[model samples]
Target: MPVLAGAEPFSHTASTEVGVLLCHGFTGSPASMRPWGRYLADLGHTVRCPRLPGHGTTWQECNRTRWTNWYDCVHTEFETLARSCESVFVFGLSMGGTLSLRLAQQLGDAVAGLALVNPSVLTLRKDARLLPVLGRVLPSVKGVGGDIAKPGVIEPAYARTPVRAAASLSRLWKLVREDLYKVTQPMLLMHSVVDHVVEPVNSRVIAEGVRSTQLTEVLLYDSYHVATLDNDAPLIFERSAEFVRSVRQVAA
Candidate 1:
């Protein structure tokens, strides 16, 4: 929460009837979710998107953290939102989605539902990740600092990819694959069938693995990895809003 994905502060302690905790992908910051958060905030729901430690900073800083630290960050946000809202729904992008799924498994009925965009869980194309030598010798990329990239669109905040962090992801995902059955909360997952990052099969796996009968997968036909900023971002946002409404209806 300290280096909150680059925004520099938390939401004012204002209360709302409904709340959402947004989580960004691995090596990414809350900036990935800021647009979505702002949109949801306009809906009169309190939204918190905390930056994972070592993110929105240097990739070397991120290299020092692991998936557990990332989960801890979002879990704190989740608990904080739970204390002040009547209902809590989680939305996450990429690895952020993986954390959301894990939390839903942990919270069960306590978490109303989830929305995932281009989730990272089964997205890896084999054991391939960042090239170790380059990650070790080369400096962070000049742009989004290990951040998410929307297809054909580029983010200046994104920098270098952290190999150490990715190594951790490779291991953490295996654990998630075995535990997917524990996520039974109603979920609406969105992914691009042609995503260059996470494979479309990842979303399919989520829709099939989670026990929730309300789970659905929305495909972004015109987007790539970072659907959040691509041409289909509007569709992702609307579909996500609808998912929250559907879950809230069920919870009500």
Candidate 2:
């Protein structure tokens, strides 16, 4: 019998010279980041968006992996991008943004900047505690986004959430919040005021917590949770490109 290579091993991205490492949301694949990745790629950025462990596969596979595996996968991709490109930027969505935050904490001085779309950190509503403990158990959410109309990116392939895997995500956020002060890299945060999945407060909290002197925020006026493929996706790409350029100028 042969051993399976796992999720990250299955994720193969085309190599590029100057690129971005894009992390997708929880229970999401590279598809979630494809729009932004392609947008950057069109602007001459090499883009790398790899699927995390137990992702882009069956939900059972996802349930078997933890947050550590997911983090390691993204970190590996980041290293690959850095080695291949003259300069590298990091971008992420939802849970992916959480991973980006952790990366910034570790490599603030090295990271050119960050692009976070609809970032998810603390998502439970303020009144969520009213529900009973059992009633509050995280539900297994499947693919819920509407149509995705982008220039180059396609719809994500996987969506079923692994309840256990989601716990790992929460655990990772717990660790990342404590180190928020360590991230000083320039950041561009984009989110919708009407996002149904991740509350806007998540992005607000991150913007307030990061110690970076260079930080910018964009509110998606006509989108929901997945702003990358929503009405404002083009703006996402444009703003991200602009932010990266500004960061480069600052460094220069």
Candidate 3:
């Protein structure tokens, strides 16, 4: 399948012995993560952002894939980074954060640290409970993309949310929540104070559930769900870089 323009995966190799793997959100392409990857790369960190399976193409095609496929893609990328770098950190936005958490849980200390932006583990929407039933009858619904507060900045995401894929995502959320205690690595979590797509409670759940003693939480007042591309983007980039450096120092 031909990927949409600006949705191709991004990779940068650097002399730094640190590797950072970025994961984009559900229905969002690598375009949403490219700038962040570039920022890290410019700072001498090796970076990669993989296009999740069933993403970067039409939403209709996304419906044909399951959450496991997306997780597998992220796992592969992390392994590649681990092979070449002395320390590998995982960074993710939205559902990508969920995948990153799962990776940390399964791989344990293999992941140096985690930096998550508006990661979703639960949704307060009452209609979300009907996804299992609705997925059987409906192909898709309205998209949840482009919730950026910054005007004229668009996220390269699907115009519609695929029903089946979303249903599978719900299952993934349940599993991740159950294993939250297994995530003991250091973490930095950033969330928008005014996000319209994911509720703030999702981040709260993660903060309360994780066993990480080195957790840092930052609230973003200027951006929405896609804060990585919004007004507080610089904050996200700088703070994450600092977090990584701090972790490296601790390891040393």
Candidate 4:
């Protein structure tokens, strides 16, 4: 499957000692996060937003790939930045947040901090339990992107959700939840008040599971799931910068 034109990976090198690795959500392209990456870069912070494997392409292609492929992509990016920067912070949206949490668990103290928007950990939806069987019969379902409150904007993602790929994501959620206690890094959790895709309970579970003493939760009043591309995008960018600075101060 050919990748979408504007959905390619985005990267910016800065002179700062702190580096930020940005991860986009499942089925989403770097197009969804490039604005935030540019915002952080403008603030003189190095930024990398990698397009996950099998994304920005046909749902058929994405269905062939699993969570491991996506995880390896971001994990490699993190290792690359870790080698060059004094401190590396991770920021993600939705499933990207799940990958960030996995990295925090695996890297431990090396991960300076985390910033996530409308992250997904667990789903209360009963249908999710049937993914394995459903995936076998139905290759795809309806998509769960472009849930932004801002009009005239759309996230470049698959129109159909690949059931097999989503089942792999469910498996990842299980693993990440088990090691949530290992994620003690400072975290900024930004979630919308009303989201039709990911339930608000997901955020509650993360708050209760992680051991981060500096966990900060902010409610987005006017946005939905994709808060990074919604009306509160500016707030997400500005506060995220402040979060990086505050955590770097503590590390220094």
Off by over 4 Å in 1: 1-15, 127-153
Best by TM-score: 3
- Local accuracy by lDDT, each model: 0.74, 0.74, 0.96, 0.92
Candidates 1 and 2: which is better by TM-score?
A: 1
Winner by TM-score between candidate 3 and candidate 1: 3
Instruction: Check candidate 3 and list the clashing pairs.
Output: none
Name the top lDDT candidate: 3
Tens digits of lDDT, candidate 1, 159-221:
566766776766677778788898888888888777666777788787778788887878788
Q: By TM-score, is 2 or 4 better?
A: 4
TM-scores of all predicted structures: 0.86, 0.83, 0.99, 0.98
lDDT of 3 at 212: 100
Per-candidate alpha-carbon RMSD to the true structure: 3.4, 4.5, 0.6, 0.8
User: Local error of candidate 2 at 9, Å?
Assistant: 10
Clashes of each: 9, 0, 0, 0
lDDT for residue 57 in candidate 4, whole number 0-100: 82
Residues 1-252 of candidate 4 have per-residue lDDT tens digits of 678987899899885598999999988889889889989999888899898998998889999999999999999999989888888999999999999999999999889999999999889899999999999999999998789889999898889999999999999999999999999999999999999888999899999999999999989999998889999999999999999989988777
lDDT of 3 by residue, 127-217 (tens): 9999999999999999999999999999999999999999999999999999999999999999999999999999999999999999999
Candidate 1 vs. true structure, TM-score: 0.86
Off by over 4 Å in 4: none
